[model samples]
Each structure stands twice: as C-alpha cells, then as structure tokens.
Target: MNLFELNQAYRELEERDDLDLETLKDTLDAIEGAREVKLDSLASWIEKNKMQIDWVTEKVKDLQAKKASLTNLNKSLQGYMTQSLDDAGIKELQTKNHILKPRNYKASVVVDSLDDLPEEFKQTKTEVTADKKELYKVLKDGQEVPGVHLKPNRGTVIK
Candidate 1:
C-alpha cells in the first residue's frame, strides 16, 4: 500500500488499542512488506541514475576548469594588449572587427596601516551571536543567563 494508506491503517490500529495478537502481527507484517518494497524501488532508481549523475558531474567539473583557464588567458591577453597600446602612445585602437580602448581606472581606498586609518572612513557596527557550548556549560553549572533558554527537541533516525 501507499504511504498515505499505510499511515491511515496505522492510525486506525493505534486508535483501537485492543486488537488481538494475531491481528497486530498481521498488520505489522503488511507494514514491513510495504516498507521493503519501497526500499527496493528506491534502490533500483538510484542504480539506474547513478551512472548518468556521475557523467554529468564530471562534465560540469571539466567545463569549470576550461572556463577558469579561458578567464586567465583573457586576463593575460588584456594586460599585454594594454601594455602594447601604452608603449605605442595610443589611447584607442580601431580595427576592421574591433575597437580597443582603455577604461579609466576606478578610485579605491587603500589602507597603508590600520593605525593611520582616517576617522571619517571608519564606522562602528554591532553584531550579536550566541555560544551554544558555553551557554550549555553555564546551564549545567546551575546558572541562568538572561534571554537564553534550552528547549527539548525530538527527531527520528532510520536504519
């Protein structure tokens, strides 16, 4: 049966707690059988798709490496072209297919030393975070910190 149907059956059985031992055993068996079938189907799907997934992963990695190489080559070529133009005492070059021009350098802040940083360029900001391990230690020591409390959590693990 499907997950929904299995859940509904389980809920019905839970609501009626006076079920006979034979009936309970049969219901347990059915649930186990359904779970086994679901597991098998999932395993089969993974087996079928694993090779294609690996291939796509490899392709993506290769493309990323190629893109990085191309980016580095482009940067080097651009630097060489700029140097050549500067050496030729030209600001712009025109060709049949392209025009090369140097863009103006942007202004940026450069700090020579932190101690020498201007007050006008400095700003203050506040950040807040909790240290869970420390907080747990304090709680375990029977001390309370304001605005901090622990709550019970629940989870399930399947094997």
Candidate 2:
C-alpha cells in the first residue's frame, strides 16, 4: 500500500479496540512492514541522488579549472596585444567588426599599510554575537537565559 493508505490503516487500527489481540498484532505488523519498505525506497533514492551530486560536483570543479585556465590565457593574450600596440605607438586599430584602442581609467587606491593609514581615512567595525556554547551549558544546567531558550533537537540517521 502507498504511504497514505498505510498511515490511514495505522491510525484506524490505533483507534479500534474491538479486534482480537492476534488480528490487531497482525494488522499493525502489516502496516509496519509497508512503512519499512517505503523507508527503504526513500533511503535508496537518497543514496543514488547523493552519488549523482558527488559526480556533478566533480564535473563542476573540472569545468571551473578549465575556465580558469582559459581566462588566464585570454588575459595573457590581451596583455601581449596591448604591449605590442604600445611598442608600435598605434593609437587605434579598426577591424571590420571591432575597434581596438587604449583608454585611460581612473587611478585606483592601493593600501600599503593599514596601520600607517590616517585615522580619518579609516573606519572601524564592531560586531556582537551570542555565545551559544556557553549558553547551551548554562541552559542545560537548568539556568534561564534572556532572549533565547533551549530547544530539543530532533534528527534522524539512516544506514
């Protein structure tokens, strides 16, 4: 039976007290068996999907490495072309589909030493966070903490 049917049967069996003990036990066993099968099927899917995820992750890493290599090559070729154009004193070159020219960009700020930077040019950031481990210890010892409370963690493991 499907999950819904199995659950319905379990609920119905739970609410009934008229059946003989043997029949009740058998019915509950049947429901439990169905649920077990469903769990097994679900776990199997999880295992298969996990394998696929690992494979895709590896593929993505490989592709990323290739892309990085290509990007570096592109940068190297562009740098070489730009340097060659500069050596030749070529201000601009026009092709059928494109025009290549050097243009000036705004100067970028480079920080040599943060400590030596002027105070007015520097900014400070502060962060505050709760100490969860310490809080857990206190809460677990039956002490109350403001703004937060302990919660029971429910989790499942499959093998």
What are the runs in model 2 whose C-alpha is more than 4 Å off? 1-33, 115-123
| Residue range 42-107, candidate 1, lDDT tens digits | 455445467779999999999999999999999999989998999988998999999999766888
**Which candidate number would show the highest TM-score if scored against the true structure?**
2
In candidate 1, stretches whose alpha carbon ends up further than 4 angstroms from where it belongs are 1-34, 43-69, 130-159
Each candidate's clash count: 0, 0
Score each candidate by Cα lDDT: 0.76, 0.79
| Residue pairs with clashing backbones, model 2 | none
In the range 1-159, model 2's lDDT, one tens digit per residue, is: 767776566556546769897996576566645566646654665576789899999999999999999999998998898888899999999989989996667988999999999999999999999999999999999998789899899965778
Can you give the TM-score per candidate against the true fold?
A: 0.45, 0.64
